[model samples]
Target: MLSRNRAAAARSMPGEGQRSSGRAAQRLLVALLGAAVGAAVAQADEPILPIPPAPALDARKLALGQALFHDKRLSNDNTLSCASCHDLSRGGVDGRSSSIGIGGAKGPINAPTVFNSSLNFRQFWDGRAASLEEQAAGPVHNPLEMGSNWAEVLGKLSRDAPLVEQFKAAYPDGLQSRNIQDAIATFERSLTTPNARIDRYLRGDKSALSPDELRGYQLFKAFGCVACHQGVNVGGNMFQTFGVMGDYFTRRGSVTAADLGRYNVTRNDADRYAFKVPSLRNVAVTAPYFHDGSARTLNEAVDVMFKYQLGRSAAAQDKELIVKFLHTLTGEYQGRSLQQADPLVARRP
Candidate 1:
């Protein structure tokens, strides 16, 4: 969370931007993390974990993850990466209901925003992967996604001495295959999207957001969308069947494996068609919506949610107000400076 790395790190707080270093230090952190995990397990209660301070973004891991994220070479046909589907400038999604991927395989779901995803309770449309570290490993090997084997990725990266050097500088254990994942994961954790005007307003600054956005917020709650999509990561903490007031699965038709959603992960018939309520922070940008990318516009998605879930229809003004409010959710990210700025990553040596 160094000031220089966060880019928008400055706020009204003191001691807000400092970087922690070394394997031993991180190991101490890991021990605490394990204890916290155990404590939560014992309680069987779900509490929001405080978002950790963004990890250091120096000239090492940041650079590596940045390269890996943007490098299409990670795909089998030299086609995609975490960035291909989730473009940073494009509100962290490719703006398709689903993007074309390796071997031109159409992804079964929409690419969720990478921004502030470190805050999500889980990864993917189903609440899976409990940590950002585990989530970071996903696309690298998904057959229809990047489609690259980690072993092959490791072999390719192992020959790059410069990448190895960057890894050593950023990771305490340095350059092992798993550590490469660690570096990329660490860099991704450092990627937090915050400081929206609405956040400031919610924090007590009355003038931070516009009147339209404020109206939108009210309509959001009154419509009871908050019942399923609430809490810090906004919506990632919970799961709900797609068509709750009515049968969404039956309506979807020609049901693909993707329609099974959480049921696919749990093997429970009751869980069928349940998907994680996605964070709507950047909804204005990431489009062709829904888990299956079935909705094409932000307004359309909002209308569908109202009709199917809330069992109400929004007035034109309310719909416009909500769209205005959604625009505030796009926090700024401009090709973030990485912990490492290695030429190898930039050049793909």
Candidate 2:
């Protein structure tokens, strides 16, 4: 009942001919009808849905992946790692306007949080990577990021016999670049953040949201923010032009190539300024917002969205309420609230 998506509902239903009979069957039918009615009501009222439980993953692969994620050997200089930019303990981001990479090089775009990244239809702000495994390989070879090739990375990683053993334990063909990517991606898939206050409310716990939060949610929908930021990940399922209603780049000034978003990937004129909508889960802590990392706070980001994306202005009270709603999107990670994690202290080179 937490999801209105038919595919999600079908996935949770019992398989094949498992059924009840007689009074049990009749009672089951009644219960199901009631649930269906409730689900319908919820569907009409809410577009966003609760994150499902993490999929069961191989423990060995998960452990190996996490190790690889933190190992600086993946970088050419042995001074940077996946965790350097995506800090799992700190909302899965490094908390910079743009990421600082190996050898003190700076990346052009803000690093999107790795949390709930698996739910995104495509990886990266431009939607260039089709899967997490592919995305994993990007930074390692990016000149401004890890700045390493698989040959160099494997050569360094091979020196560690213990790490090689980890590879052997996790994959049939061990210590290969593909396996490393697989292991890292497998670990990343485990980073889903669930059980936020909105999730509880969506799951039929009416008291989960305070009156103000509820009002904020109502305003979020009424103001059409839900048009782009809906579904399970609450914004990752699709792509939209950054300035759907107005010219955000010109107004902001000094637009760079990164501001082109999907246009860089497809080289399509229509794709200019288009980007994959980022997930809002744990968004409160994953600032500053947007690919440029221009917004310093949620309020500023919301104001920008209203002006450039919605082509409208909101009442100050309405905007404030919407910010309150966004705060409720922060959820738990590994049985702990994400808010409990320390904010990213910028690590300058």
lDDT of 1 by residue, 115-218 (tens): 77877778888767777667767788888887887777777777888877777787787766566666666667766766555555554466867888888877
Worst 10 residues of 2 by lDDT: 340-349
How many residue pairs of model 2 clash at the backbone? 0
**Local lDDT at 319 for model 1:** 82
Q: What are the TM-scores, per candidate, against the unseen true structure? A: 0.76, 0.88
Model 2, span 27-81: residue lDDT tens: 9899999998997698657799899999999999999999989989888888999
Regions more than 4 Å wrong, model 2: 1-37, 40-45, 340-349
Model 2 residue 86 CA deviation (Å) reads 0.8
- TM-score attained by model 1: 0.76
Top lDDT prediction, candidate number: 2
